[model samples]
Target: MWHFAVFLLLIYYLINRRNSKYLLYPPGPYSLPIIGNLLSVWMGLKNHKYHHKLWQSWSKIYGNILGLRLGLINVVVVSGRDMIKEVSSREVFEGRPDGFMYTMRSFGKKLGIVFGDGRPWSNTRRVALKYLRSFGYGTRSMEVIIAEECSELVKLRASDSGQPVLVNQMFNISVINILWRVVAGRRYDLNDDRVKHLCGLVMRLFRLVDMSGGIISFMPFLRHLVPKLIGFTEMKAIHASLQTFVKETIEEHKASIDIENPRDVIDAFLIEMLSNKENAFTEEELYVVSLDMLEAGMETVANTAVFMLLYLVRDENIQRKVQKEIDDVIGIRQPSLSDRSRMVYTEAVLLETLRLSSVAAMGIPHMALEDAHLGEYLIPKGTFLLMAIHDLHNGDLWEEADTFKPERFLNEGKLVQDERLIPFGLGRRRCIGEGLAKSELFMFLTHILQKFNLRIPHGDSLPSLEPVDGLTLSANPFSVIFEQRSS
Candidate 1:
């Protein structure tokens, strides 16, 4: 038994050495025997508070295409605008990294649009986009849905009696309702307790799982050995809650089905599940996909809206400028989708918020389907590709990258379409809800500013601009007094 175990270790070492010799991988910090650069990355995260910034610091030493290994898995970190674009567009770099966390979220298999790869992902994404669009996604009808929700939100905030409201999770239900109207054909009340609990769970999950996949991805054994200590228990509890919610919602939809005329994405998926014989289109897929839509849709727009408000509150001049634009174009009337184009400064403010905040700092990791050449380096097959999205936005590509200058997005008082400003990402795997998110941001921000003057509490100091880093970037806990504007 001892001889066999030793033989197995020798063979594994041989394979690792052979793979390294064959490919001239991108340069990175020295990798110790079995652990690789895992310690360095872990420490980087500890010091930097953000994976994107950690990778950016490494890129300075190793150049744009930095390579490393986390445990036995080979990984490559890509930075710079052109390099990231190249990786994103290439078909070979379109696959997603597989791990315990990816599967844990999707009922012990890769079934959803976010992490699923190969034909399953392509098929799921296609059907999702098709049905979502059919049900008013990215259309003018979505504008009405968002507008109505904005009205409800305004009413809720107005009832606060000009008190400072902590906005970290404030927009969760409102944003979720907008997506729910399209997905499940229903919206929750802004103050729904269950919705609030679910949103809290989602945010907790965000903080627990970073882009690097955390300890579970590298050492699955740790989960069993020290489950609670490594956050496995809390993560499992969150998933269970999410699964229960999704399961109940799907079951409810199943009970009331109108095959001839589907109500929303859920009804549409149920109809598809009945007809499609493929494994990808099933009841399980429906559950996971629904959760994906809600979690992805809710988090991005809500966090971004909060970040925008935070920035505006921090800089009163920018706030006044955006408000002036709103008053000039929207007047006393509610802002419309058509007003977005005319509100150039307001649009620039939104663009700058996206650029600066970078909620999804490190985007969903992509895997190399085959040996691919990224820049001058050879990215090995099965290597997980991490794009430095936050770094790209804050890199040398922009002048005064750290500064909150909305004018960066404007040229001669017109919104300039800069390819470098890819908040929604690029290529086939880019975020599908870009239009919906944009519309929500525009409507929510404009609606709030139109009705209220956002300010810090009466005696408190200015709220910190430093973001709470997670799977996404979120503003630290801060409150805003929504003082109603005089008519």
Candidate 2:
């Protein structure tokens, strides 16, 4: 009787295994029951870079598109340029996952532009683009605003030029000022306690999100059950703090809001709120949208600028080349948008910096809206998608892919553009702040290089290039000594 039962159990196991094969999920690391590939993911999160490296390895084993069962959710990681292009552009894959953590961040609803999808996302995105463009988003007028902000930053740094200065917050303050001007029609003083506190909160939020991996992201129940243990308490506090700032700003705007002549993004949004009462627009939505702008706009540009400085200071040759290009083209006059066309090497360095330090490494995750075919595999409805940007940028497609070679972006002494170089992402959901970011990067970097010679402080050791693992990759805090350059 025991032998007969053993034979029956073996038959049952085989039958289930065979049935599972017919599910048509893309190939990935074998997942255990219930927990699914959570352990593998957790291990990767422990070392932030490992998370990206693990995905790259899995891509090789499972081909370009690989799927993993991440707890209850199905995750599909798409690698390679062609695959990313195809998957990123597909409407079926454009939806963002409505996970527990995702909704909670936006006041328990999909109220913001970054994570929200469907008609609400479409409507807000459309309005935002329209108004932002009207307010000189990608134009020469925007360059003038950024240049003026850069000049203020330059004066601030000039005061302590020869000393070793921590530039992390300095970059944050400078970048935030430009966005603040665009959005609120005013800039915060660098020494303002409120600005300092806000910057600290934003940094903490990014760090917490990175450390938790998918724990805080996917499982909302843990937040309620073990709030302190899982960082949910701290996360909520940060969210509330940011929300308070946005609310206060909006209230101030409301007091002076003009229906006839809007001052900035806040005023524009308020006007829209009054005009389109029946649309998805709301006061709450405006708060979240402003939060999104400040968070996304500030971090991406600041972090990338910091990383660019880190790279240039480490390699003196690259720095000389960029500085020489700036001197030749712009000749110490404030770098403008028009000079961007002539600064070939400077442009290449910026491109390479962006490629090497992909700020939004994995980008905000995309959801599979419905069952769809990607290449040969069938991606089921509701599967979460992560564009393997880290893998795509560092793939075999680029020669010397791992090295910090700016020349890769240059050909015949001219900047060479590649479609695969998507630092700001692609498709309908590409970062709305791309143009603003590019303008800031060019203006700030050119101004800094033109004015100062960046170096590791005298008698100090070189800082580690390894980034702090976060929602966006940022260089570990380091100091640089800037010697004023003679024109």
Candidate 3:
């Protein structure tokens, strides 16, 4: 049986190699059979995180585009902006990965605008955009909530009395609170047992994603084998916990849904659930959709906020300028979302933060649906696509791209938004939470800065800005003092 299994795998690789027959592709290191390029690629580096220098090194040697084998999948990374746009085009890249994410799925039957395709995705995206437009995504009405959260951040920092407080916890609390209200219609204490457990589950799920070798990804049948063969008990436990949270939220929404008085996301989903019987979805879809939203909405925002906090601490000059912008525009009074436009420097700071952190370093991996030419390269159908967004963020496509100058994003020092600095991605499958996220960050960060001056603890130097190993890259354990500013 074992001999046959090995034989079958060898045959599969031979076939996949044939499928990868493309001459226009960028140069890559030599690949070996069975293991293809995995052994050589991973052998030298502990994991991809430590291998950051590898990407830069490879770019110098292999041009902007390169190919490698990620398990059974063929990963083609586009490093150049032209290549990025070419791949992101709807005609070339139409499909997405069907990873373990599909198997562990649990959310509201409605997929958040993030992962859905066809009509389901369209409906969710349209509704979300329309609803956000009305409720002030980057507008003033929504800024009230952000102001409150930032106020809390300031209060928490002041409580430290210039002592260093680990912002990982604070950052998580603020973003989670915002999402809690926006999506779930509830907020839990920062130290709440369930909140802590949820964080743990999210952290573990991300870890599983990070170190998840290509073992089971190639074949779902291998899930059982890989877990037992590799001991993925903790990952399973994390999935179980996450699944439970989604299930509980769904059940709660089902019980308390009011058709006429829809408020937060739960009520909104429930209303859609009850009103549309024929075209309606089931509880399973509901659970899965909710899970997707929680993961996308919460994960990115939390990571972005946390890193921005760390960056502000390290770069005190930027922090002071942002606070000055906030004070000039919003005054001692709380900042509403509308204030973002009035405060150019504050908006620029947020943009700079997004650029510098590059939290999702390797943009969400997408899969090609058909054979297409991206730039000069001929990409085959079903090839996995990962763009070097970190490089793009650092590239000269935009003025002052590498510099953390908010002035570049401003006109005569007035706040402005440019689509070119696209951190949320572009086209149809772009992040649905883009509008809400910008609002959350802008309103929250400026408000916090206005009330507290963020500074790294003087005792230890600031943490290096090197990326982490997980799907979401964050500054490693770093401490910052949030000294209160007199009103």
RMSD of each: 2.0, 4.7, 3.4
lDDT of 2 at 342: 83
* Prediction 2 TM-score vs. true: 0.93
Candidate 1 residue lDDT tens string, 1-487: 7578557655785677678533588889887655678788877878887777888898899998998877667778888788888889999999988777777887678788888888888989999989999998888898999999999999999999489898889899999999898899888999899989999999999888777677777666678779998789999999999989989888899999989989999999898877766643878888888999889988888999989888988888997888898898989998899998799999999899999998888788899999877777788888888889888888887899888999988889889987888888889999988988988899998998899898889887887878887778889899889999898
lDDT of 3 by residue, 173-276 (tens): 66777656666677666567887668757755664544222444544456666675532566667767888887887778778777777667666656766789
RMSD of 1: 2.0
Instruction: Report the poorest 10 consecutive residues by lDDT, candidate 2.
Output: 13-22
Q: After superposition, how far is residue 234 of candidate 3 from its true place, in Å?
A: 2.6
lDDT pick, better of 2 and 3: 2
Candidate 1, clashing residue pairs? none
Assess the local accuracy of residue 78 in candidate 1 as a C-alpha lDDT between 0 and 100. 85
lDDT for model 1 = 0.86
lDDT of 2 by residue, 261-329 (tens): 999988999998888777637887888788888888888888999988889888989888888888888
Clashes of each: 0, 0, 16
